[model samples]
Target: MMFEENPPSSYLTRAAHSEDSQETITAVSHVLQDQENTRPVPADNSKSFAASGDLPAKPISPQQRLARLRLLMSRQKAEYESKIASLEQRHRELQWEIRDTHWQLGQQRQRHRLAEMRIRDAERAKEDAERRNEMLQKEMEEFFETFGEINRWK
Candidate 1:
């Protein structure tokens, strides 16, 4: 009686509402055989429940669920912030270590260059000392040549 009393506004919803009843399907089949026309109204979905998630399923509404799911794979809120901060700190430490290593490398290279120059200077000094010793030895031999004649005469 209530179904007969009130018909829904939309034709699609009205037809869909009718299809919920066995008598309506029979009537619709007979009407189709006789070549009749009918319109349906949108169905009420207040009592329906979604198969997944806490949100209701709609024709084209996903922004709400998507926003909630954006951080689904991420760490918890404050924990992620702390993790990022810690990672950045470690990166800064690594950068400082790299800088220190480069500086030490530069210092070692300078020492090597200076040592090479000193070695060359030392070689030259040693050669000059050897040359002076030979010149002194020849002068001493000339001085002893006169003494040898005096000793032979005595």
Candidate 2:
């Protein structure tokens, strides 16, 4: 009923006059076929349609197909570029973390060395203190023995 009112030729005529007519028509046909179960009118009726100052439906052109292919390639390129940038950023962050870890390890090694030195010094000081205590105990025993002998004589 809708085709009877506006006619299929009128749609093709408009499509033929557009810059990217073939692509537009194909897109419209696909949409119509999907949404309303409609089929594009064939080009075999061009003679009759032309006689009535209209055009007939034609297939998509090579130029239009190439344009769609180019568009798809560009989108894929953009997606890959985005992924590469993210990976590079992650790599940089990982490098910084590794550097920080190395620094911390160096600091810990230095602290361990200092603590070892302090422990060695403490051991030496304790040995010296023990030797002095032994000497003082011997001197006190000799003094007490001499005092006991003098008391016995008195």
Candidate 3:
């Protein structure tokens, strides 16, 4: 009677004004369905709705709820900030360790190269010494042969 000949607009206004009995029933049913689908928020006790904190177990005013939500958000933000700081510190440490490792590896490789060069030089010197010894032995044999010939003539 109030919305004579304007059924759709009347339904929309009723839904908006929270006046329709059918809309209220549907809303309540949907809420129940959602509750059935959801896992319970961990409560201190089965009867209490509060989590494991000092917050109220029963429903509070809207202002108190808003304050609690803000506190939870701030706590989460602080935790994220702490985690990021720790990760950054660890990143810097790892970078320094990598650089140190690289430097040490380079020095070790240089020392190894120098040792190889020294070994090559020592091997060459040994070969030269062996060749000189062979040449001296040949000279000594020739001298002895010539001395024997000279003594025979004498």
- Measured by lDDT, the strongest candidate is 2
State the lDDT at 40 in candidate 1.
40
Per-residue lDDT of candidate 2, residues 1-154 (tens digit): 2223333344445666789866566744643334233446557775558665464476555565546535644665687688899999999999999999999999999999999999999999999999999998998898889998989999
Native RMSD of candidate 1 (Å): 20.0
Ranking by TM-score: 3, 2, 1
Error of 2 at 54 (Å): 26
Would you estimate the TM-scores of all the predictions?
0.45, 0.53, 0.58
Report the alpha-carbon TM-score of model 1 versus the true structure.
0.45
What's model 2's lDDT at 26?
Answer: 70
Worst 10 residues of 1 by lDDT: 1-10
What candidate 1 gets wrong by more than 4 Å, as runs, is 1-84, 150-154
What is the Cα-based lDDT of residue 44 in candidate 1? 45
Off by over 4 Å in 2: 1-59, 150-154
Worst 10 residues of 2 by lDDT: 1-10
In order, what lDDT does every prediction score?
0.57, 0.68, 0.65
